[model samples]
Target chain A: MAMSQATAAGPRRNRVLNGILVNGTLALICLLWLVPLLGLLVSSFRERSDITTSGWWTVFPHKSYISAKQDQLTKGLALDKPIQVEGVSLTDDQLRAGYTLPDGRKLIWANRRARIVDVQTSQWTTKANFTTANYQAVVLGQTYTYKQSDGSTKTEVGEDMSKAFINSLTVAIPATVIPILLAAFAAYAFAWMRFPGRRPLFAMVVGLLVVPSQVALIPLLRAFSNLHVNGTYLSLWLVHTGFGLSLAIYLLYNYISGLPREILESAFIDGASPFTIFLRLILPLSVPALASFAIFQFMWVWNDYLYALIFLGSTPDTQVLTIKLANLIGSRGQDWHLLTAGAFISMILPLVVFFSLQRYFVRGLLAGSVKG
Target chain B: MIHQTRDAENKRASSAATSGWIPGQFFAGLLGVVVVIALLWAGFIYLRAARSASILNAIVAIIWGVGGIGALFYVSNTLIEALPQKSRDRIRPFLFFGPGVVILFLFLTIPTLITLYQSFFNNDTTRFVGLSNYIATFTDRSMLESFRNNLIWLFLGTGFCVSFGLLIAVLADRSKFESLAKAIIFMPMAISLVGASVIWRFMYAYAPADQPQIGVLNAVLTSLGLQPQSWLTLQPWNNLFLVAVLIWGSTGFAMVLFSAALKGVPGDLLEAARVDGATEVQTFFAIIIPYIQGTILTVTTTTAIGTLKIFDQVFVMTGGQYGTEVVGTEFYRQFFTNRNFGYGAAIAIVLFIAISPVLVYNLRQLQKQEGF
Candidate 1:
C-alpha cells in the first residue's frame, strides 16, 4: 500500500529522472525527424547566389559581409587579383591613380615604378550576401522566354510547379477516387457474397495483388490500342483503376468483413435495398477503411511517375505532377531548390490528407493489427 | 408417397431450409448462381457482338441477346423473390456483392489467366513457343541482376523498415506530443512514392567535372571539412540507398499501426507494474508489450508484403539502375522494355510465389481476428 501510494502520489526523484530520459529521447527523435525537411525548406528559400555564398544554416541571422572593389584599385589589394582580403582591402594604385589622401600632397609609390594591373584573382567567400531570388524565380518569372509588355520577346520563365501541381490534382483525384470507389464495391462483394466461384474470385483478386502491374502493361496497351482509348485521362484512370483495384479491394475486404454483421442485417430488415443499405449503413461506417485506402491510393496515384510516364507520357499536357517534377530533376533531379519546393507542393495534398484523416489511419491500423 | 415427397423437396429447394435461417442462405446461393449465369451471358453476348453476326441486325442481335437477356433474368428473379422471406435473406448481401464479383472476374481474373497463356508465347504474343521466354529470363544479364536485387530488396528492405518502424513507434508512445510526433513520421507517408524518389534523387545529386558539388550532403561534407562522395553512383550500396526510400515511405504506416496497438495496451497494467516497483522501462517491456505483440506481427507482415511488391519507386528513380532492380520493376522491364511476355509473366509468377506465404500469413492473421 505504501509503495503503491508513493509511486502514485509523488515521485519527485523518479519523475525528474524519467522525465529527463523520455524528454531527451523525444527531442532527439523530433530533431532527427525534422532534419531532412528542414534541410529542404531552408534550401528552398535560398537564392542561387546565397546558396553559392553560404550554407542554408548561415542564411538566417548572421550579417557577415563579402566586399570587393575592382573600381578602387588594380594591384596590391586582390579585389579581382590575388593577395589581400578579409573586408577592406588597400591598394597603392588607388592612392596614386585617383583620389587625394588626407595629407595635402597627392600620394604615390617611390616613383611610377610599379605598373598598374587589373585586379584579377580567385575570389571565394562564405558570407551573408543572400537574397530571395530563388523564390522570385519560382513565383512570378524566370530567365525563360515569354511575350513582353510591348509585344516583343522576353524571357520571363515562371515556376512550372503551379501548372504541374494542378495537372497532378486533375489526374490524381480521379485516379485515386475511381479505383477506390470501384474497389470498395468489389471488396464488399468479395467479403460478404457467396457466388459459384467466390473463393476463386477472391483468390484471383489476392493473386493479382502479387501479380506486378507491369505484367499487364503490354496486354493493356494492346487492349487500349484495339479499343482506341489511349492517350487520355480516361485511359490513365482506367490503368490506375485496374492496377489499384486488387489491393484496394483486398484492403477494404479486410475491414468490410469485420463490421458487425447485425448492423447490415438490421438495415436489410428495415426494407432498405442493397444500394440504400450500402450508402446509409456500409459507406458511412466504412469511412475509416475507405479513407485509409483513399490515402494509400491518393499517395500512390499522386506519386506515380511510372503509370503517368508510360501511359500519359505520349503528350506533355497529360503529364502528372510526379512526371513533371521528375523531369525537372534534370532527368537526374540535381536542381536542389526547385526539388525542395516542388516536393513541398507535391506533398501538400497528402499531408492534408494524413493530418485530416489521421484519426482514421490510426483506427484503420489498429483494426488491421488487433483484428487480423 | 413419392409424388408428395418430391413436392416437399421442391418447395424446400426453392428457399433456404426447413428452418427460417436457412431460407436466407438458400436464397443467397440461388442469387449468386443467377448473377454468375447472367454475367457469363453478357460475355457470351459481347463475344457474339462481332460486327459480322448477321450483318444488318448485328446491333439488334447484340443488344437482344446479351444485356437484354441478362437484365431479364435479374429483374424477373428480383420481382419473383420480392417476398424477402427466410433462406433468401442472403440474397441481399449477394445483391450487394454481385456486381463486384463480375467486374473482378472480367478485369482481374481474365487478364491473369490470359497472362499465363501469353507467358508461353513469342515476343508479340502471337505464336506459342513454350518455355522459351522463361528460359531467357534466367539467362539475361539484366534479368539476373533484377532477380538478385529483388531478393535483396525483399529480405533486407522489408526487414529494416518494419524493425525501425516498430522501434520508433515504441519510442513515440505516451509522449506529450504524440500526435505531433506521429504526424512528423506520418508526413512522409503522404508523398507519392515517386515524389519521394524524386526528392531523394536531389539528396543524392552529384556534380562533378569542374563543378563544385552543390548537393546538400556534399555541401555539408565540404562545410565539415571533408571530401565529397558520389552516393548514388556507388553500386551494390546504392540499391540499399534506393531501398531507403521504400523504407521511408512505409515506416509511417508501420508506426501508425503500432501506435494504435500501443494505445490499446491498457494503462492500468503499466500502472500496476510501476506500483510493483518495476522501473518505467521494465514496466513498458513487461506490461505494455505483451498486449500489443499481435499488432507488431501484423505490421511486420503488412510491410513485408508491401515491400515485396515495390515497383513504382525503383522504376521512377533509378529505372532500376545502380543494381536497384526489384521483381515488380523487373517484370515490367522484361514485358515492356525487352518485349518478352513469357519472361515477364514468369517473373510475376516468381513474385507471386514469393509473396504467397506472406499473403497466407496475413490472411490467416486476419481470419484469426475475425474468427472465420
Candidate 2:
C-alpha cells in the first residue's frame, strides 16, 4: 500500500528506486536475520577439526587445507622439492595439517591432531562432506579418543544431553500441564463467577505477573534445599507451575470472560452445577487460550536456564538441556560442531511447536501483551 | 437477527436471575479443597519416601501431579454435589481459585518476601548486617559493572528489537512474500536463549590470525584483510555482543506484534492522508506510527524488562567473563557459584526494584485495555 502510494506520488525514477530499496532492504534484513542460524546449521554437519579450522562458509569453496610451517622439522630434512601430501604442497619445513584429499578424503593425524587437506579444488563440486558425527557425539554421549603424551590413546566420554533431555521433559511436561489445569479452572471462576473479593484478587494476580523470577530464586532455593526437593523434578515442576500461574490465569481469564454467557446460563438452567459448566462447557470452548498458554509455558520451562541451573544445579544426573548446553559452551567452547548440534537438539522440539502452532503462539503474545 | 435476539435474551435472563446466596455446601467444598491438597502432599511425600528417585519415579510423580490434581478437582466437585444448590454456587469459586492462588503465594510471593528479608543479612544469613549487602551491590566493582551492562542491555536491546521490528513490519507488509519472509525472520524466537548464544558464538567465533577464522564476523573481517578479533572476550564491547543475541530473538516477537498492529491501522486513513497530498514518509510517521503507539510501548516495556534480567547469553557465551556481567548472571554467580547468599539476595531485590516501575506501567496498560 505504501509502495503504491509512492508510485502514485513520486517521480517514475524515484519509484523504481523505492521498489529496489524496499525489496532489497527486506531481503537483506531477512538474510541478516538468518545468518546466525545458517552458521549453526552449517557448523553442525562439519567435522570437529573442520569446524575449528575455518568458517562454515568456506565449506562451499572447499579449500580445506590448514598450512602451518614448523622450522624444527627442516633441520634434518634433505628433500629439495616441496613435500606433496594429498595434493597439498608444503615446503619440507612446513607442516601441512588438517587437509582434505583430492578425492574428498580427509587425512587425520592421530598424534598431531591435524587435518590434511588438498586446498586445490577448482571445479564447483556438487557434493559436500556433511557428517552427523557431532549430533551423534552429543545425543549418544560418544567418546573421543585422544592420544596421551606417552603415545597411548585414551577415550573420554563426551558430555551427552540424553539424560538431561529426559530430565527436561520430566520437568517441562508436568510443569506445563498442571499450571494449565489450575489456571483454566481459576480463569473460569474469575471470568464468570460472582464472588466476594474477586476483583481485588484478580488484580493481585495481575500485579504478581511482573514480579521478576530473580527475587524468588534465592528464597525458593533455600526453602527447597530445606525440603530436600531442590534438585528434584518435583521442585522444578512445582516452581514452573507457580511462575507460570499469573499469566496463565490472566490470558485464560481474558478469553473465557469473552465467551458467550448464554452457554453457561443455559447449562445452569439445565441443572448442571457450576463445576460441570466449567468442566464440560468452559474448558471445551477455551481450548485456544488453553493451548496458547500451554505452548508459552512449555517453551518457557524448556528454554529456562537460570531456574534449572539454580534449582536443579549442574549435576550430571539432574541437569536440564539448558544447563547442559551452557556447560557444553563452557567446557568445550571451541567445539563448534558439538555446540551447534547440541543447540539444534535443544531447539528442535520448541521449533516444531512454534512452527506448527505459530498462529496460537502469536495470538498468545498479543493477548498476553497488548490487548488482553 | 440471531445476534439481536441473543442480546435481548442475555439482558432479560441476567435481569431475571435471582440474587445469589451462600449455602452450607460452601463449607463442605472448602473443606474438600484442603483435604485434597493434604492428600496430594501426602501422596507426593509417600512417593518420595518409597525410594530414591529414578526415571520411573519421575514419571510416576509426573503422573501423580497431573492426574492427582485432575482427580482432586473431580473429587471436590463430587463433594460439593452433596451441598445445597445455592451453597455449591458460592463454594465452586473457592475450589476453582484455590490451587493456583495457593501455589503462587507459596512459590512466588512468599519467596519474594523471604528474599527481601534475607537481603539485609550476612552471607550465611545468621548475622544481621542491615544495608551492608545493599551497599555492596552499589559499591562493588563487578556489581557496578553488572548494573552498567544491564542499562546498556535495556536500552540497546530494546531499541534494536523495537526499531528493527517496526522496520521489518512496515517493509514486509503487503509484499508478495510477506508471510514467508516474516516466518524466516520469526524463526529465532523459537530458539532458547542458550541456543541463540551458541549460534551467535559461532558467528563471533575467532581463531588467531594464523588460523582461518571460523566465526562469521571474524571471518568477514579476516576476508576483508582486517585482524581477527575475539568478539566475546573484548572488554566492554562484549556486553553489546551478548545484547545482540537477545535482540536477535526479540525482534521477531516485536515484529509479529507490530505487524498485527499495522493491520489494525485503517486503510481509509492512509487513503485520506494521501488524498491530502501527504508523502509516504509523512503518512507513516504521522498516521501509522501514532496508530501503533500502544503496541510499541507494550513491546518496548516488556522487552526492556526482559533485557534487565538478561542472563543466559552472558552466561553461555562468556560466563560473565570479559566484563559482560548482567544482574541475573551476577545473582547466579554470587548465590550458587560464590556461595554468597546475602549478596545474591540483594542483587535479586535490586533487580526487583528496577522492574517494579515497568510492572506498574504494564498493569496500568492492562487496566486501560480492560476499559476500566
Candidate 3:
C-alpha cells in the first residue's frame, strides 16, 4: 500500500508540474502580447509631457512623492525672511541648495526656483496620470495658442479624425455588403445550378484567391485615372468588392453546397421557381455563412491601406482611417500622445466587431482555411 | 421518388419555355429595374454632395449602399423571371454571376494582364524595355536590399508567428483562463497594421542616454544599467525589430487556426497513447503534430504569403528607411514615388512569381479535395 501510494503521488505531482509549466508559458506570452497594446492605451490617456518624459507603465499608483513648484509655495511671501513650507523652516543656504521636509519629504532648489517634494505616499493616486485630452484632440480637433518670438499669439488647429471615421464607414459598409450580396448569388449558382462553364469558372475563382493584389495596383490606378474615379469612395468600394469576391464566393459555396438537398428538392416539387427558392430557402438557411463572410470582408476593407492609398487619394476628405492613421504616423512621428489616441480610435470599431461577433469571425476563418 | 419529382420539374420547366412571354410582367420588371437605377443614381449624387463628415451623411450612405443593392438584386431577379423560360434559364445564372465576374475580370484579371504588359514598357510607356525591367528588379541596389529584407521578413516573421501561435494554442488548450488568454493574444488581429505600427513605435520609442526613456523596452534596458539604444535604427537588427511588429500582430491569427486544429485532434487517440505508457510529450509529437499537419501547412503558407506582401508595418514604422525595405514598399516607391512604372511592374511580377508556387499548391489542394 505504501509503494502504490508513493507511485500515485509521484505521477500526480508530475501532472501538476506539467500543468503549471503549460499555464505559465501561456500566461507569459499573453502578457507579452498585451503589453504593447496596453502601453499604447495607457499612453493615449496621458499628458503629452508625461508621455515624452516617462514610460506609460509608470502611471500606476506607487509609493512616490509629489513635487510642487517653488512659486506655488512662496506665493505672496517675503523671500528675505526664513521661508516655512509645510511646517518646515528652511535656512537660506538650505533653501538655495536643498532641505528635507519635516514629514519625510525633500525640498530642493534648482534652476533658481524652489521646489517642495511632498512626503512619500502623499501623492500615490493614479488619477493625475490620465487625461482624455488626447482623444478629444484626435476626434474633435484641438486648438493651441502659441506666443510667437515677436510677442504675438498664433492659434493653430489640429487634424480632426471625424471625417476619416465617416469615410471609413462609407467605404467599408458598401464594400462589405456588395461583395456578400454578389458572392451569395454566385455561390448559389455554383453550388446548385447546372451551368455549362460552372466548374471552370469556380476554378478560376479558386486560382484567383492567391493572386497577389500588388499586381493589380499600378494598372488599376491608371485605369481609375482614365475613368476619372480615382479619388472617389465608389472606386474603393468596387475595388474591395472585386478583390474580396473570390474568398467570399469560396466560403459561401462551401457552406451553401453542404446544405441537405432534401429541402431544395421538396421545394422544386412544390413548383417553386429557382429565384424564389434561392430567396426564400437558400438565403435564410445560409445566414451563418453570409455573416461570417460579412465580418471577414468588413474587417479586410476597414484595415486596408494600400488600396485606399492608391485608389482613394490621401486627401483628408477621402482618406480612410488606415490612411489617416498612417499619415499621422508620418506627420506626428514624435507625438506619441496624438499617435496613441489616433491608433486607438482607428482600432475601436474593428475591435468591437471582433469581440462581439467573434464566434462568426472564427467560424469564417476556419471555413476559409480548413476545408474537409 | 426523387427521380420522378425531378422529371416532373423538368417537364414543367420545359412547358413554361413553350409559353409566350407576358408583356405586363416584363414591363413591370423593367420599371422596377429603372426605379432601382434611379434610386442608386440619386443616392450616389447625395453621397457625393454630402462630403462633409456628418452623422446624417453616414446614415444616408449606409442605407443607400445596403438597401439600394438589395433593391438592384431583387429587381434584376424579377426581370429575369419575366423573360421567356428558355431565355430565362440561360440568363438566370448570369444575373447572379455577372456582376462578380465582371468586377473580377475588370479589377483582377484584366489588370493583372495589363500589369504584365506594362512590365515590358519604359517608365512612361513611351518605349519598350523588354527584360531590362526584370533585370533591374534582380540587380538594382535597393531592389536587392528589398529582396534580402523580404526574405528575412518571410522566414523570421512567419517562423515566429507559427511557432508562438502553436505554442500558445497548445498551452492554452483546456487551461483555466483559456478564453481570456486567447482573447488577449488575438486582440491584435483586429487592429489595423498602421495602428499596430504606432503601438510598436511606442514600445520601441527612444531618447538620449541621459533623458528618461519613455519607450518601455529602453526604460527596462536603462534601469538595468545598459545604454539606451535606438531600436528601429539599430542596423540589420532593426529589420528583426520590424519583423517583431509583424509577429506581434499576426501570431494571434495563426494561434486561432492552430487552436481549432488542435481541438479537432481526437481525445481517444491521446487516451490510447497514454494507456500504452507513452509520455505526454511523446504523444503530442507523434500523434497531435501529425494529426494537425494540414492545418500547420495552411497556417504556414498563409502567414508566409502575408509576410511576403508585408507593407503597412514597414511603410508606417520605418518608411523603408534604415534598410528595412521590403517588396511591397519597393513596389510603392518605384510605382508612385519615382514613377518607374516598368520597374514597379517588374517588382510586382516578381512578387507574383514568388507567390505562384503557393498559389499552385493551394489550387492543387482544392482539386485533390474535390477528387476525394
Judge candidate 2 at residue A159 and give its lDDT.
61
Per-residue lDDT tens digits for candidate 2, residues B215-299, read: 7888789889899998888887888888888888999999999999999999999999989999999999999999999899889
* Candidate 2: stretches off by over 4 Å: A1-17, A61-127, A144-156, B1-35, B46-59, B84-88, B366-372
Give the per-residue lDDT of model 2 (tens digit) for A1-372.
998987877677876887788889899999998888988998888776667655677667554334232212323344467655544665533443444555755443322223332334334432256887777788998876544546587666666888878878877877888788889888888887778878777877887887889898888877787887866677777788889999999999889989987887886666555665676788889899988998988899999987888777788877889998988888888767788999999999999999999999888988898863
DockQ-based CAPRI category assigned to the predicted complex of candidate 2 = acceptable
Better of 1 and 2 by lDDT: 2
Candidates sorted by DockQ, best first: 3, 2, 1
Q: Write the per-residue lDDT of candidate 1 for residues B1-372, one digit (tens) a residue.
A: 534644443464445233333545446646766776677555444533332212233234334333443453355345434443543554544554455455555555666667777878876777888887778777878778877787777778778777777677777775677777778877777777766776666556565524555556776777687777777768888888788777767778877777777777777877778778998668767776777777767676667667777887777777777777777787777767777777777776666566678667655544454323
Displacement of the residue B4 alpha carbon in candidate 1, Å: 41
- Against the reference, the lDDT scores of all candidates come to 0.62, 0.80, 0.83
Every model's TM-score: 0.74, 0.85, 0.88
Candidate 1: regions farther than 4 A off: A1-11, A52-54, A62-163, A179-211, A247-276, A284-288, A364-372, B1-94, B127-129, B207-213, B272-290, B366-371
Candidate 3 residue-wise lDDT, B1-372, digit = tens:
645644665665665567756566678889999999899898776665554455565567667866776787778776776678778888888877776777788888899998999899999888998899999899999989999999999999999999999988988895887899888998898998888999999999999998889898999999899999999999999999999998998999999999999998999989999999999789989999999999999899889999889999999988999999999999999999999998899889999999999878876776776522
Off by over 4 Å in 3: A1-3, A63-109, A112-128, A144-156, B1-87
Classified by CAPRI criteria, candidate 3 counts as medium
